[model samples]
Target: MGMAVVTLKKGEGRLLKSGGMWIFDNEIDTVMGNFENGDIVLVHDFDGYPMGRGFINTNSKITVRLMTRDENVDINEELLEKRVRDAWEYRKKVVDTGCCRLIFAEADFLPGIVVDKFSDVLVVQSLALGIDRFKETIVKLLRKVLAEDGITIRGVYERSDVKVRKQEGMEMVKGFIGPEFPTLVQIEENGVKYEVDVKDGQKTGFFLDQKYNRLAIQKLCKNAKVLDCFTHTGSFALNAGIAGAASVTGVDASQLAVDQATANATLNGLSDNVKFICEDVFELLPELEEKGEKFDVVILDPPAFTKSRNSIKNAVKGYREINLRAMKLVKDGGFLATCSCSHFMDYELFTKTIGQAAKNVHKRLRQVEYRTQAPDHPILWAADESYYLKFYIFQVCNDR
Candidate 1:
């Protein structure tokens, strides 16, 4: 296929030059050029200097998500194989253990695509229109790279159940790409064992990024009563239980998550200490307060509230509301581990929102620790925005 030439308007080339992956629609001088969706476009400065080669989609607000900024790059099947192999090599070197986040979108120089490898199998998610068009190439490269390394790919599943897939004009696809389905695979994270459900569970079956954070909580849960809110799959609750928490209450809105959490607790032999409850967290927080129940350690990790810039205001309100009630439910001198996965909400703003929420509840707050995604999920130094996960470990001060 021939590549389309796309020259950016004045200053539009700066982002690409500085290693930014996305090119917004308004930044393009497209009056002189028109490219169909999924077309490979060679981007250039207005002065005719080449910027990069990337897939273009006029339908999306993100006009271009650069796959490669190299002027000589083609981004075809062979190149895709190299990218996949290179990503795997980096992960293998960095992660001595078998379990880690294998591919992080822009951080690995491949925009709009994320692939997570749990042992011999792989789970891939296409998040952008441009990447969706190249899904075949990605799959081929994954198979080739695995074969070349003498590793048998037990299965390759497509879990594009994320909302972003619909926005990209692609229906959610979930199925095994390879010949076989993988049974639940065991992976150890910071001494805790987890079974990942790549074909069925949320986000490639596990939140590998929170692997370390869960371990951090284990230290404080000795004989403690822990409340794990929005605990999908019971990672925190199970950790607390395994760490000798007197009791762990795990709450989630999704019945499936509750069931999964229960099963996970049983798998880890922590069902005796952990209890799973399926309920709306927004309502349950208040109900816990009404029941005069307080926790020694509280964990609140909700799904992203703000997907776009327009939803920032409402998202902030949601964050503050949850944090406020969460703080109240934590006994004085206890820890409150709050997290925001929303990329639109920066770390500073997220913490500030939680602080404001604590003040509203008349609780004295002391920042204990700052946390982020696991090491396998490396963030590109050039792309700070890709560092979307932010966590805060705070203590409810009693001195007032």
Candidate 2:
């Protein structure tokens, strides 16, 4: 195969030298030759020496996502297979639970792709132009890796509804890739059981990234009155109930999510202590406060408020608004669990937003735990930008 080398201008190689995987279009000085999207090309420095091997996409803002910095190595099926196998090996060694993020995007050195393994099924999402173009190869690699491990995967479902895909000029597509669709599957994590819908529900049927956070809240739930706002499928509320909360109330704008949450609660035989409301959280919180409702714990895990840089300011307001309301509702000293999946909002800004909210409510907070997407949604060290999920568990305090 003919080789195409991409050269970077002075100082543009800093991110690469620092082990970062992405190279934006503006960072490159020249592309020696034309290469198809997802084509692995040799990267050269300003001095024209081979620097690395990476996937290319001229049409993307991110022109390159490097797979390796080793000059002697060639990027091929063998290398790809090795990466997948290595990811599996790491998961096996650390994550004993069947429910976990199986393949993280850049952390696995495969940018723009995510794979979540639940029971016997695998849910994959491709958000980059290069990865979307090479999805067939990725699918084949997944199957081959599972087969080699003597594991028969029941299905491979696609959940590529991410907004990033649109920027890559790809439309949202989802469904079963195998012979049959899985309407529901039972998964156990941290000794808690869950039934996830991989076909038509949230990311691969469940937010497996919150596995640990859910379990953490479980330990604090005994005899506590819990309120789970934006309670999609009631992962937090149900976990609270099952973990021995005196009672749990869940609220969401989606009746579908409410229905599913109710069904999940019943599945675990915790319906007696759990209640669901299909109401917009923005309006419901104040009503609950007026009704003299107080909870020992409250969870606020909303969808991404900022999809791009343009929406960040408004998104911060949204985040701060929800947090301020939730913090007020929690009894003094009660736990407040809040999260943001917006990549455009960094942790510092997110915390600052929370701080502003706390000030607005005239309340103080003590952060107890800081969390991110689950281990399977690996944050590649060089690619902190891809690790967008953030969570903070705090204890509400009285104003001085």
How many angstroms is residue 324 displaced in model 1 relative to the true structure, after the best TM-score fit? 1.3
| TM-score: model 2 vs. ground truth | 0.94
Write candidate 1's Cα lDDT for 1-400 as tens digits: 5567777888775666676787888888753456678777888777888777888877777778788878697777777777778888887777643667667888887788888777777788888877777776787777677677787767778888887676667677778775767657766666556677787888888887887888888888999999999999888888888899999999999998898888888878888889999999999999989999889999999999998889999999999999999998999999999999888998888988987998798899888899998777887765767788998888897645
lDDT by residue for model 2 over 130-222, one digit each (tens)? 667667677778778878878778878888977667666678888766677656888766655667888788766788878778877887789
Best by lDDT: 2
| Model 2, CA-based lDDT | 0.83
